[model samples]
Target: PPEPPTGVPPLDPVDPRYIGPFRLVGRLGAGGMGVVYAGLDDRDRRVAVKCVHRVLATDTDFRERFTREVKLVRRVRAACVPDFFGADTGAEVPWLATEYVPGPTLADFVRTRGPLSGQALAEFAHGVAEALTAIHAAGVVHRDLKPGNVILAPDGPKVLDFGIARATDGTALTRTGGLVGTPGWISPEQYRGAPATDRSDVFAWAGLVVHAATGRGPFGSGTSDVVVSRVLSEPPSLLGVPVHLHAVLHRALSKAPEARPTAAQLQQAVAGLPGTERHADAGSPNRTWAAVSVPLTDPREWIRGAPRKRSWARRHRTALTAVSGVLALALVVGLGVRALTGEDSSLPGEPSGPGGTTGGSAATGGTTSAAGAPDDAPEEYRDLYETGEVVVEPASQDEPVLVRRLEPSSDGGEPLDQLRIDFSEAVSGEFVDFRMTIDLEYLPDHGSLTVHSNEFLGLRAITPGQENLDFRTVGNTGLLAELTPDDPTETVRLTFSGGVAAVYFVPLETRARAQESLDYPGGFCVPRSMSGVSETREVETFPGRDYIGPLDTTLTNGAPLDNCAYTEDSEYQ
Candidate 1:
């Protein structure tokens, strides 16, 4: 008897009554090519039903591919993959059923939250590796190993959707010019028109690992074209990955197919991994034939740029501003108001009294103010406000347009520095109002600013003002402010000399938390260092700089220490 079609109308007009001896219960998941339904077998066991798309059921090529996938999946029976139950080939929609496993997919889980941690990620990798081993053993290539395909059931990981997979001996189903699999996870070999293999699965797995670690793909976020370019031309860097597991992931992401470990090798290597969760001798029924309604072959069509992180500051700028007063302490030191801490008159190096630094001479006063408080209001409004002194631009008497003074602590206290400048009290004109000063042991000759995701870091120093500045690091990391303000001038500036000094400007509470985890690596307050010092050094004319390529090395080495490179590189897989 022909089994009644599942709930997807037109394909299955009648409600699905039974699939083989199993009684159809409800729908579990759905996709472009199929819909997964919950069902129960003869012994009243729960099962998943995957009903193929009607379009594919009518198309000879799709039908052949679907038939081949069902047969191939039957050969791989392991804990890592859903158990293959039975296929209702007799149904017009060609449904497959597998044991029902409850849990969110790795993709959905990450989407709802973010990336998984080191230990959980490691175990996830191990489980998937084992699954791929079983599939490869049957001479089938999964072709796709993205987070979307892995189900995080209560028991263990279950690899799903072998719809586009190719059997070693089966004929090609996709057209000659057609591309298969997710572009971000696609291996270099795939782009070069090389045959897909177990190694290709490894490459895709590495991309998923990156996504799982940083809540992002290794090459950053973008359209399929951008992601493909990165995979083909660029080498993968495991930034944001835990330092301990860097070596393990490098091997999996190697560009060269021959360079990567085989599924069995990867499985064995990860099996004894130190930090992993395991289940006892529990038995899980095969559910590979489960009814699923996901678009199996059109991955390229569904690939989307990872969602962008919206700044909490931008949404509630006013609330952020209020809270920012509390948080702004880390961001600004001297500009605090009563509502905010009212500006501190004792900024780094201002001489005492009006006769001291402000009014020494319109000549000395102008220069000193320029060097001391560039943002000071014009003398016209000296009494306009209580603390109406400029904190950003200083008087010209301050010497260099941007002067940094550092007083190193002999007692090993916090390294504190100050900048005193005085600009026109003129609240008018196109005044570029911003200040970035740091105190330390020394400064570097050249530097760059790196804006990754939401955080921005001024890596080094070329000069003090716009007259001679180097914009080398502006777009090096491909962080071109896709959604926010693109102009760097609008954002805060960070002026610092090259030197080692423990500096943090996070919220006081966050700063305390960071101090507590000084030894732990990763995340904010982890005590990452930069390369630069501010001690006495010969002044050199700042030079215009050129673009430095992407920093594609280990997180510790490639990323600047003060404004210089000091960390070591990791082995490329």
Candidate 2:
């Protein structure tokens, strides 16, 4: 027997009582493809089921495309996106069911509640960037990421309705003639008819941020064609944005995709904002923030031409002028803010465990306890230990890679010198294919990196073009790779062992709440010297005066050993 429709809305004349096994409860709305209905499963759980329009449902080509796209969308697994439940393309009116998220759209929220501010604003930035990171990692470009597509749910912001998302590998369903996104929030590349990429979505994300903060897009009000033309030609108007976010958003709304930060880069940059939260584990109460130099994917992407000193200060001054006197302190220090004086800033659904990660908090400021320590020391560093995340930006890449900075926990009262590393990202396109390359450390001249790993995952090194000096220390086994003798900008392969390992990207619940994976147990605990007299050093330099790295190893007391080096090289997996 056919299930009866759950009556709650003015349904479309063509709306069916049921699609596949689920009964349609009410019409949610419609997009270019078809009408969406609030659906219920056999056990009465809710799901958002979108059915293809009658006209397109009958077309075999469109049907095949719809089927393939649904499968592709299923690949995304971020908490920001609703869970993909199932899809039935063979049904008369093909439908896709996803976990139904009850919330008002960002557009509706902004229209009614005015603009988001303070911690709410910061959380939204982090959440959206997290979503973009997940989406782009899956190789999908959400061509339509306007406020209307984002829903403000009880938990946090959840990006929904991938009505026009296209796979990055030339799998666009829409033809070339018409615009593929909503105006004002649409990227300039979309207006110019250029193919969309991850960076393109970032451009739209900036517009979304602007709209969320000021209740309007950067382009203001205009006809769709006018808005498209304005996006194509003029710079975004950030008049109403707070000082801290303005500096970041300006770069995000760059006309050139290359000028903008990648989704991963944006995540790093947003951490410095006053309202930006840090990721810490509820289980690991003893573990504090550590300073780490993030490795980039390439060396060339860092050069944005002409480093203007006092530029950030100048922007701070501007933000100060624009904001009320009450926000003076925040405007000046907000860009460099790194507050670590409260409960860990873990977001809703964020996994917590005995092992947690600092998503490059070193970029904001390493936490430190030195009385004479530079005012700019990262906030992630703890007082007694040389532990925290280090953010590295090399010549070859834009995305920041994380390296742990751990020191033997100490009981000393004196300040200690610390270590800093310069890293250039791998230029090889085979990063996806190159499995088993875990646990890497970049050093300068003659210094080697000491790697301490979890039991299941061990660290061992391979020889690169330049030889590593033979050095041994107890409680710490050091592995180091130097720049090729001739070219400081040259690329090299630094391999690792302890059984082939790769970061498992599968999403769902995991045993390790702090571990952001389905399989990998844990990462290495990199040790640093916990002594006094801190200083900074340069690693290497490029022709355009863009040099970043210099091994800064110190000789202070070591912190307590989380896990010492593995003495044996084999017989374990």
Candidate 3:
């Protein structure tokens, strides 16, 4: 027949040549349930055929549950769902066939291309919601609605693999005392041993969208126990998610199943979003997804272009804990909490160090200046550096640090606003670098600051009861800071309806050194000879501002510096 699709591995020696009326051409993938093969029907139409493993095929309970779910899956008719063809439940090795969708999984897409944004992100969310609407309407709950199950085709996104799905009224066939879903994507109620429902799928959908937008699950990455614990207690970190869609997703991820919106309501909310009109208007009539007849490109070509560096098993090992009833037992004994917090026993809102400064060095705690600035700071910009917090010594080169909190503050004067960032551990002066750039062309002025650290790990917001802060600078400047942490370098974009005239760098320690000198020789309000330095310059539009940067300097242990500040001006150029 047509040459097997590239990236489709050749069938193994023990593989069957045929399953019912379809000819197995190549192996697509294998999972806990069975092996999926690329096959062709008598008419030569390509299909994805999933055959139940022999071990599972011998289990009468599994066979009965599979048959029931198969009937429910057949009832699902949606444009965003692959067309189900047929199945043979009575075969020696039961198999089901569906349309062969040639595309990368959403997990692969996001990992390779970075997180989706703007219209693309909106379309992806809307399409998946539409799929859920159709599935739920058919009385089925896709217990596992994760990034791996969504395929990103050129036409649109398609939800795949209903292998773990079941009818709303159907009895689950999970092994006794075992949980039935992926850890990070599974709902809290599911972990609590509740039956999977439509609302549970909604919780998973929100998590999938979060993963698509942030390149990480809502609960963050870790061992299964850690992720499960975070899902049960810690709030999701939506730092990189678009601000507008946060509310709906947050509501959808509510711990209470009754509190979450239904699939239909979720579809409507997603379709009604501000920038999703194009996708919304293109919605299929009768709420059914039309199969795209367009020929797919050779998978080999694209697969080579963006190689999947991590195998499915390797990537999900930590999240694939086959949770047993003992999970509740472990939680009861505080194992979950201990695992969640790791060796660092500090909890949210706990005192990080001396002086209330989150990352202050307890060993050499010192008082602040009269103006609230660190006592060792330069006299010229002391007020600008003051934050009413105790100052600590500079961190050593190997100490790991992270941005633990971000908030707005005043510099005790006019025209300048500050967005203070606190670290989980004291920042290593010798290994940290800061660079800020501003762009004034957009209606709401925007710019970015890069915080690069050799010892930087990731973000960890420790403010109790507040996982995320409202985007606001002093005077309600409407200043929003969106942090995208990519390990070693975290970029924070500042968007506001005002102008930024200058940017300053202040290390909290009394003794810090510079890895390199500042770029702007005369831009500093305070002498460069001092640890703390500032850059004053005119603001310019897009291309013009592209070349202008506040400064780029790496701090080392030497002179005292404390934090960074951005001063706004009405007459900024």
Residue 93, model 3: Cα distance from true site in angstroms: 0.9
lDDT of 1 by residue, 396-508 (tens): 31122322222111222221112222111111112221123321111211111121111112222221111211111111112211111122222222322222112122222
Off by over 4 Å in 1: 1-15, 167-177, 277-573
TM-score of 1: 0.45
- lDDT tens string, model 2, 1-573? 222233224455666655654556567788766778876654355667887667666667766766666655666666667777667676777778887676677798788768887767766776788778877776667888899888765556778766334421232225532566677877777677788878888988898889888998898887887877888898889888888888779899999889999998887888677866644731111111111111211212111111212211121221111222223222223222221212223223221111111111211112223431224433333332333112121122221123323322322233222222223331112222211222243322221222221101212322121122111111111112222213222222232211221111111111112121111212222212111212222222222212222111110111111112222222111
Candidate number with the higher lDDT (1 or 3): 3
Clash count, one per candidate: 97, 47, 17
Tell how far residue 230 is off in model 3, in angstroms. 0.9
The lDDT of each candidate is: 0.45, 0.47, 0.51
Winner of 2 and 3 under lDDT: 3
Consecutive 10-residue window with the lowest summed lDDT within model 1: 518-527
**In TM-score terms, which candidate is top?**
3
Q: Which stretches of candidate 2 lie over 4 Å from their true place?
A: 1-14, 167-177, 278-573
Q: Give all TM-scores, in the order shown.
A: 0.45, 0.47, 0.49
